[model samples]
Target chain A: MNKRNKLLIRKTLISIVMVLIVIVSLFPIYWMLLTSVQPRHELMNYPPNFYTRHPTLEFWKFTFKESILEFFNSLVIAFFATIAAIICGATSGYAFARYKVGGDTLPFWILSLKFFPPVVAIVPYFLMMRTLRLIDTCTAVIITHMIITVPFAVWMIKGFIQEVPRELEEAAMIDGCSQLNVIRIITLPIIAPGLVVTALFCFIWSWNDFMFALILTRNKAMTIPVAIAGMREAHGLMWGEVSATAALGTIPIIIMAIILQKYLVRGLSLGSIK
Target chain B: MTVKKRALMLVLPTVVVLALIVIFPLVFSLSVSVRAYDIRIPEHPFIGFGNWISLLKNPDFYSAVLVTGTMILAELFFELLLGLCVALLLLQLPRSRKIFQPILLIPMMVMPVVVGYMGRLVFEVRSGPINYFLNMLGLESLCWHASPDLALITILILRIWRWTPFVMAVLLAGLLSLPMEPYQSAQVDGANIWQIFIHITIPMLKPIITLVVIMRSLEILQTFDIMYVLTMGGPGAKTMTLSLYAYITGFRYWDIGQASAAAWLIMIPLSIMVTLFVKMMEKGEKIEQAK
Candidate 1:
C-alpha cells in the first residue's frame, strides 16, 4: 500500500476510536438530560425512549420548589468555604513560595492532609460539631469542608505563587513596599489567574461535596447533593426528579470544568505533575 | 517585623485552620477509636484497642478491605490503559481534541452522587438503555448492580467512566509537554512506532504515570459517594468498599468507636502511602530540575 493511503487508513481508525470515546463519555450526561425532561410514564417503556416526544417541566419545577433552599444553602456554604480557603490559603501559599515557610516537611504535611480520607475525619467532625451545637447547620458543613478545600487551595495557589519570579517581589521590597502591600500589589496581580483557578476549584469541591454534607447537615443546611439523595420515596427512586436535580447540579460544574480545562492537569493532580 | 516573623504571620491562618480542621479531628478520631463511644450512648467507656481488636477480627472488615483493594486495582488498571489510549489518540488529532476534549470531560464534572444516580438509571435491569442495547445486539439483559456477582463491576464501570477522562487529560498534558529531541533521535535510529512508544515514550512518561496512580488510588480509596447513592454496599455487601463500610458502621449503625477504629485502619496504610508518594514526588521534581 502507498504511504499516503496507509496514513489515511490510520487516521480513519483513530477518528473512529475517538468518536467511540466521545460517545461513551457523553452518553450518560445526555441520558441524564433526556431523563430529566421525559414524562414519568415514558421512562418506564421497556425499550426506553431514547428521544422523548413529550418533554415535561414538572420535575424541574418540583426540584426548584423542594430543593431550592438546599441549592441556596449549597451556594452559601461553598462560597464562604471558598472565600475562607483562598484568604487563608493564599497567604500561606505566598509565604511558602517566597520564604519557603515550614521548610520541606511542613508543606508536605499540609499536602498530605489533602489526601486524608474524609471518612476518617467525618466521625470526629460529627462528634465535634454535635458538641459545638453546630450539627445540621451550614457552619458545621462549611468548617468540615475546609478540610478538603484548604489543603487544595494551599497547594494549588502555592504552585502558582512559585511561578512568579522572586526578582519582581524583591524589587518591590527594595522600593520600601511593606510585605502585605507587596503581596497585594505585586504577587496578587501576577498570580491573579492562579488565584481564580484555585478559588474555582475550591468552590467546585465544596459545591459537589456529598459525604461531608450528608454526614454533617440533616436538613437546615443540606446541600444540593444531600437533597438529591433524599429524593427517594417509598415507591423506589423518583427517577425523573432525581435526574432533574442531577442535571441542574451538573450544569455549573460542567461549565467550570470547561473553563478550568487549561489548568485542569495542575489543579486536579494537586500541582504534582505541573 | 523581621522576615521570619512576617513569614510566620503569613502562614498562621492556614496553620490554625488545618490544625483545627485536620489535626484536631484526627486526634479526636484517635481518642474515639479507643473508646466505646456511640452517639446514642451517654456514658462512653474507654476501651483501649478493644474496638481495634474487634474490627481486626470482623469478617466484614476483611470483606471491605477486599472490595476496596479489588476496586483500586481494577479501576486503576482499566483507567490507566483506557486513558493512555485516549490520550495517544487525542495527541494524534490535536485539531479534533479542541472540540472533543471538553465533551469528553463532561463525565468527570458530573457529581459522583449524581453519577451514582445516573448509574442506577442507566443500569436499570429492565428499562435501562444498557439492557435495551443488549437486546438490540441479540443478548439477554443481565442484572447489573442488583446482582451480587455484577454489583462491583457495575460500580467500576461508572467510576471508570467518570475518572478515565481525568487520567486522559493528565497524560495528554504530559505527552504534549514531552520534549521533541528524544522522538527525533528515535526516528533517526529508524525505530518503529511501537518500539519508540515502548522504549522512549513509556520511560519518559513514568513520572506522569506515577502521578496518575497516586491520585487515582487515593480517590478510589475514598469511593463512598457513588456506592452510597447506588448500592449502599448492598446486594449483600458484594460491593462494599472501605469508605462505604466505614460510613455505614459510623453513621447508620452509629457504632462510633468501631467506625473510628475502621477509619484509623484505613488511614494507617493511607497516610503511609501519602508520605511515601510525597517523597517520591519531591524526588521526581528534583530530577526534573537537574534535567
Candidate 2:
C-alpha cells in the first residue's frame, strides 16, 4: 500500500476504536434510560428488549409522585451544603494565601484531612450529631459534607489563588484598603472563575455523596442516592422505579455538565492532573 | 503582643472547626477501636486490641483484603495502560485535540453512585445489555455480578470505567506540557516510536505517572459508593472491599470497635502509599534541579 493508503487505514482503525470506546462508555447510561421506560412484565424478558417494546411512563410517575418529597429534601440539603462549603473554603483559602499567620504545614495538614476515609469517622460523626441534637436535620448532613468539600475547595482555590500575582493584593494593601475590602473588590473578582468552578464542584460532590447521608440522615435529610437505595422493596428490585430514580438523579448533573462544560472539565482535569 | 494576639484570634475559629470536624473524630475513632462501645449498649469497657485481634482472625476480613488488593492492582494496571494509550492518541491528533480533550472527562464527572447503578443495570443477569450482546455474538450468557468468582472482576470493570478518564486527563496534561526537543532528537536519530517511548517519553513522564498511580491507588482503596450501589459486597462477600467491609461492620452491624479497627488497618496502607509518594515527589524535584 502507498503511504497515503497506510495513513487512511490507520485513521480508519483509530476511528473505529474511538467509536467503540464511546459506545462502551455510554451504553450503560443508555441502558438505564431504556430500562426505566420498560414495562414491568417486559423487564425480565429473555434476550432482553434492547428497545422498549411497550414503553410507559408509569415508573417515572411512580418515582416522582411517591417520592417527590424526598427528592426535594435531597435538593435542599445539597444546595445548602454547597453554599456553606464555598463560603468556608473560599474565605479560608483566601486567608491562607494572603496572611502568613500560620506555618506552611497548616495548609498541608488541612489538605491531608481530605484523605481520611469518611468511614473512619462516620460512626463517631453519627454519634456526635446525635448528641448535638442535629440528627435527621439538614445541618447535620451539610456539616458532614463540609469535611469533603472544604478540603477540595481549599486545595483547588489555593492553586488558583497562588496563580493570582501577589502584587495586586499588595498594591491594594498599600492603598490602605481593609482586608475584607480587598477581598471583595480585588481578590474575589479576579478569582471569580475559580470560585465558580469550586462552587460547582462542591455542589456536584455534595449531591453525589451517599455514605454520609445514608448513615446520618433518616427521613428528614436523606439525599438522592439514599432515596434511590431505599426504592428497593422486600419483594424484589423494582427495576423500573429504580431506573427512573437513577435517571432523575442523573439528569440535573448531566445538564449542569453540558451547560458549564468548560469550567467543569477544566476543574476536573486540574484536580486529577495537578 | 497585641498584633500576635489578633493574628491568633483570626486563625482560632478555623482551627477549632477543623479540630472538631477532623482531629477530634480521628482520635475518637482510634479510641472507639480499642473500646467496646456498641451504640446499643450504654455502658462500655476498654477491650484493648480485642477488636483488632478478632478482625485479624476473621476469614471475611481476609477475603475483603484480598478482594481490595486484587481490585486495586487490576484497575491500576488497566488504567495506566489504557490511559497512556489514549494520551498518546490524543497527542497525535493536531486539530481535534481541543474538542476531544473535554469530551474525555465525561466519565469522571458522572457520580460514582450513578456509575455503579448504571453498571448494575447493564450487568444484570437476564436483562443486562452485556449478556444480550454476548448472546447475539453466539456466546453463552455469563453471570457478570451474580457469580461469586466474577464479582470482583465486575467491580474492577466499573472502577476502570469510572477512573480511566482521571488517569487520561492527568497523563494528557503531562504529555502536552512536555518539551518537544528530546522527542525530535530521538526521531532524528532514527529511533522507532516504541524506542522513543521507552527511552524518552516514559522517563520524562515518570514523576507525573508516579503521582497519578499513588493518588489513584489511595482513592481506590477507600472506594465505597460504587461497590455499595452495585453489589453491596454481594454474592457471599466476593466483592467485599475494605471500605465496604468497614461500612458494614460499623454501620450495619454497629460493631463500632471492629469497624474502627478495620478503618485504621485500611489507613496503614494509605499512609505508606502517601509517604512513598511524598518521597518520590521530593526525589523528582531534586532530579529536575540536577538536570
Candidate 3:
C-alpha cells in the first residue's frame, strides 16, 4: 500500500478503536440512565430490559423529592471545604514559593502530609470530634476533607506561585507593600488561573471523597455517597432508588469534568509535584 | 524585627491549623493504637502491643492482608497496562483528542461510593447488565458478588475503572514532556515502535510511573469507600481490606485499640512506599540536573 493509504488505514483503525473504548467506558452509565427510567418490573425482568419498555420519571421524582437532599448536603460540605482549603493552601503555597522558609524540609513536610493514608487519622479524629461534640456534623466532614485537599492545593498553587518571578514581589515590597499586600496585588492576579484550578480540584476531591463522609457523618449531615449506601436495607435491594441516587450524585462531578477537563487533568498530574 | 514578626504571624495560622488537623491526629492515633482504649469501654487500661499481638493472631486480619495485597496487585497491573495504552493513544490522537479527553475523565471524577453503587447495579446477579448481556450472548449469568472467589475480583474491577484515568493522565503528562529526539534516533537505527517503547519510552517514563504506582498502591491499601458501599466486606470477609476491617472494628465492634493497630499496619507498607518514591524522585531530579 502507498504511505498515504497506510496512514489513512491507521487513522481509520484508531478511530474505530476509540469509538469502541468510548462505548465500553460509557456502557455502565448508559445502562444506569436506562435502568433508572425503566419500570420496576421491567428493571428486574429475567432477561433484563436493554431498552426501557415503559420509561418513567417515577425514580427521578423519588430521588429529587427524598434522596437528593443528601446530595445538597454534599454540595455544601464540598463548597465550604474547597473554600477553606483554597485559603489555607494558597497562602501557605505563596509563603513557601515567595519566601525562603529557612529550610526546604518544611515545605516537603507539608507536601508529604498528602501521602498519609486518611485512615491513619480517623480513629483519633473520631475521638477528637466526639469530645468536641462535632461528630455527625458538616464541620467534622469539612475539617477531615481539608486534610486531603489542603496538601493538594498547597502543592498545586506552590508550583504556580514559583513560576511567577520573585522580582515582581520584590518590586511590590519596594513600593512599601506588606507581604500580604504584595501577594494580593502582585501575585494573586498572576496565579489566578492556578488558584482556580486548585480550588476546582479541591472541590471535586472533596465532593468525591467517601471514606471521610461515610465514617464521619450521620443523619442530618450525611453526604450523598453515605445516603446512597444507606438506601440498601435488610429487606431487599432498592435497585431503582439506588441507581437514581448514584446517578444524581455523579452528575455534578461529571459536568464539572466535562467543563474543565484540561484544568482537571493538569491539576491531577501536576498537583503531585515534590 | 517587626517585618520578621509579621511574616511569622502570617504563617502561624496555617501552621497551627495543619498541626491541629494533621499532626495532632496522627500522633493521637499512634498513641491510641498502643493503648487498650475503647469509647464504649472507657475503663480499659493502657496496654502497649496488646492489640497488635491479638491482630497478629487473627485469621481475619491475615485474610484481609491477602485480599488487599492481591486486589492491589491485580488492580495495579490492569490499571498500568490499560492506562499506558490509553495514554499512548491520547498522545497519537489529533486535535479531536480534546473532545474525548473530558468524557474519559468522568469515571475518575465520580465518587467512589457512587462508583461502587454503579458497579453493584451493573454486576447484580439477576437484573444487572453484565448478566443480562451474558445471557444474551448464550453464556452463563455469573453471580459476580455472591461467591468469595469473585467478590474481590468485582471490587478490583471497580477500583481499576475508577483509578486508571488518574494513572493515564499522569503518564500522558510524562509522555508529553519526553523529548522527541530519542524516538527519531531509534527510528533512524531501524527500531520498531514496540522496540522503541521498550528501550526508550519506558526508561524515560520510569520516575513518573513509579510515582503513579506508589500513589495508587497507597490509596488501594486504604480503600474503604467502594468496599463499604458495595459489599461491606461481605461473603464471609472475602473482600475485607485493611481499612474496611479497621472501620468495622472501630465503628461496629467499638474496638478502638485493634482498629488503630490495623490502621497502623496499613500505614507501614504505605510509609515504606512513600519513602522509596521520594528517594526515586530525588534521584531523578539529580539526574536531570546532571544532564
Candidate 4:
C-alpha cells in the first residue's frame, strides 16, 4: 500500500477503536438507565430489550421517596466536610508550600494519612462517635469523612499553592501589604481555581462515601449510598429503584467530572502528573 | 507573630485535627488490637497478641488475604494494560480526543456502590444483558457473582471498568507532557513505532506508571463499597477482601479486637508503601526542580 493509504487505514482503525471504547465505557451506564425506565414486566424478560418500548417514571418516583431524605443528609454532610477540609487543607497547604513547615516530614506524614485504610479507622471512629454521643448524627459522619477529605484537600491544595510562585507574595510584602492581605490580594486569587477543584473533589469523595456512612450512621443520618445499597427487596435487589437512584446520583458527578476534566489527571494522581 | 509562629499558626489546626483523627486512631487501633474487646461484652480485658495469633490462624483471614492479593494483581494488570492501550489510542486521535475524553471518564465518575449494583444487574444470571449476549454468540450463560468461582472475577471486572479510565487519564497526561524531540530523533534514526514506544515512551512514563500503580493498589486494598453492595464477600466468602473481612469483624460480628488486629496488619504494609512512594515522588520533584 502507498504511504497515504496506510496512514488513512491507521486513522480509520483508530476511529473504530475509539468508538468501541466509548461504547464499552458507556454501555453499563446505559444499561443502568435502560433498566430504570423499563416497566417491571419488561425487565423480567429473558432477553432484555436494548431499548425500552414502554418506559415508566415509577421507579424514579420510588427512588426519590426512598432516598430524598438521605440525599439531603448527604448534601449537608458533604457540604460541611468540604468547607472544613478546604479550611484546614488550604491554610496548611499554603504554609507547607511557602514556608516548608515541618521540614518535609510533617507534609509526608499528613499525605500518608490519605492512604490510611478507612477500615482501620472505622472501629475507632465508631467508638469515638458513640462516646461523643454523636452517633446517627450528620456531625459524626462529617467528622469521620474529614479523615478522607482533609488529607486529600491538603495534598491537592499544597500542589496548587506550590505552582503559584512565591515571588508574588514576596513582592506584595515588599509593597508593605500585611502577610494576610498579601495572601488575600495575591496568592488566593492565583490559586482560586485550584481551591475550587479541591473543594469539588472533597465534596464528591464525602458524598460518594459508603463505608463510613454505612458503619457510622444509623437510619437518621443515612447518606445516599447507604440508602441505595439498602434498596433490596425480598427476592433480590430492587433493580429498578436502585438503578433510578444510581443514575440520579451519578449524573451530577458526570457533569462535574466533565467540567473538571482538565484538572482531573492532576487531581487523580494527587498532582504527580503536573 | 514571628515568621515561625505565623507558619505554625497556619499549620497547627490541620496538624492537631489530624493528630486527633489520624494519629490518635493509629494508637487507639493498636491498643484495641491487643485487647480482647467485643462491643457486646462489658468487661474488656487486655489480651496481648491473642487477637493477632488467632487472626493469623484463621482460615478466613488467609482466604481474605488470597482474595485481596488476587484482586490487586489482576485489577492492576488488566487496568494498566487496557488503560495504556486506550490512552495510546486516544493520543493518536488528538482532534477526536477533546470530544471523546469526557465521555470516557463517565465510568470512573460513577459511585462504587452504584457500580456494584450495575454489576449485579448487568451480570444477573437469568436476565442479564451479558448472558443474552453470550447466548447470541453461541455460548452458555455463566453465573457471575452468584457462583463462588466467578464472584471475585465479577468484582474485578467492575473495578477494572471503573479504574481503567483513571489510569488512562493519568497516563495520557503523562504522554502529552513528554518532550517531543526524542521521538522525532528516534523516527529520524529509522526506529519503528514499537521501538520508539518501548524505548522512549515507557521510560518517560515510568513515574506516572508508578503513581497509578501505587494509587490503584492503595484503593484496591480498601475495596469494600462494591463488595459490600455486590457479593457481601460471599458465595461462601469467595470474594472476601481484607477490608471486607475487617469490616465484618468489627461491625457485623462486633469482634473489635480481631478487626483492629486485621486493620493493623493492613496498615503496616500500607504505611511502608506510602512512605517509600512519597520519598520517591519527592526525589523526582527535587530532580525536576534542579533541572
- Winning model by DockQ: 4
Ranking by lDDT: 4, 1, 3, 2
> Candidate 1: TM of chain A?
0.94
Give each model's whole-structure lDDT.
0.88, 0.79, 0.81, 0.89
lDDT of 3: 0.81
DockQ of each: 0.80, 0.49, 0.63, 0.82
Q: Give per-residue lDDT, candidate 3, residue B60.
A: 97
TM-score for each predicted model, relative to the true structure: 0.97, 0.92, 0.94, 0.97
Ranking by TM-score: 4, 1, 3, 2
- Please give me the DockQ of candidate 3 compared with the native complex: 0.63
Q: What class would a CAPRI assessor give candidate 3's docking?
A: medium
Candidate 1's residue-wise lDDT over B43-98, tens digit each? 89998999999999999999999999999999999999999999999898877788
lDDT (10s digit) by residue, model 3, range A56-156: 88889999998666877899999999998788777677677656453456666666677778778888888888888998899999999888787777767
* Tens-digit lDDT string for candidate 3 (B159-272): 888788888878887888899999899999999988999999999998788888887887888888888877889899999988899999988998888898998898888888
Collision pairs in model 3: none
State the displacement of the C-alpha of residue A142, model 1, in Å, after optimal TM-score superposition. 0.4
Of candidates 3 and 2, the better by TM-score? 3
Number of the candidate with higher TM-score, 2 or 4:
4
Q: Which docking class does model 4 fall in?
A: high
User: What docking class should model 2 receive?
Assistant: acceptable
